[model samples]
Target: MTAPIYVPFQHCDALRTLAVPYGCGIDTVGVDPASAAPAGIPEPTLTPGRYLQEIRSAIRAMRALHDLLPPTA
Candidate 1:
């Protein structure tokens, strides 16, 4: 089976412009759930339940999009 095409971070804007022609949309995930403790940065202090919920939501969104795409050729 062919793998899903992966565009680098720098090329994201280009992908957005080309998405229409390619019949695909971009999905971005910027959060790192593994980092529970704040590292000098102002971040939300989510309870374990909330953290897991956020992760589940993101995964659900991605999976939904993946299901819509045609299988790799």
Candidate 2:
């Protein structure tokens, strides 16, 4: 993965297509070590620790929810 290039988080979605021509092809974006999301794109202004905690919590909830469902015969 390539190194990150910081950009405003507000422009995150909009800048993606626009940046492609500037040589920011999809592969050039790096994975964020903290959030495990794409890098270069600005991290959300929210607290990283809290955000990650919430993500993990949500995943656990989803797994638990799936487990609660009846298994296919």
Candidate 3:
């Protein structure tokens, strides 16, 4: 895990880490789902790390393209 980055506006003390199924993004990472259920928000399956490779590839491509593009005014 990467070192925690500080965001001044965030309440770090209030953050809670909940375990979700592997590869599934946690909807209740910070807030409990039971509290949110009353709002009618249906939890959806979130794919964690599925598109990560593609994202890293895209970023690398962008960095490569940056060197190829001529400098702008």
On a 0 to 100 scale, what is the lDDT of residue 61 in model 2?
50
Candidate 1 per-residue lDDT over residues 1-73, each given as its tens digit = 1111112331344343556348566564444533543567654455688657656655655565556557998
Instruction: Give TM-scores for every candidate, taking all chains together and pairing residue i with residue i.
Output: 0.41, 0.36, 0.33
Alpha-carbon shift of residue 41 in model 2 (angstroms): 30
Please write out the lDDT profile of model 2 over residues 1-61, one tens digit for every residue. 4223232221343234444335443433545545665567664555778657656655655
Tens digit per residue, CA lDDT, model 3, 1-73: 1111212112221121112113334321345444555577765433456346445644555565455556999
Off by over 4 Å in 3: 1-47
Q: How accurate is candidate 2 locally (lDDT)?
A: 0.47
In model 2, residue pairs whose N, Cα or C atoms come closer than 3 Å (at least 3 residues apart or on different chains), thus clashing, are none
Worst 10 residues of 3 by lDDT: 1-10
Pick out the ten consecutive residues of candidate 2 with the lowest summed lDDT.
2-11
Best by TM-score: 1
Q: How much lDDT does each candidate structure score?
A: 0.47, 0.47, 0.37
lDDT of 2 at 47: 70
Q: What lDDT, from 0 to 1, does candidate 3 have? A: 0.37
Could you tell which candidate, 1 or 2, scores higher by TM-score? 1
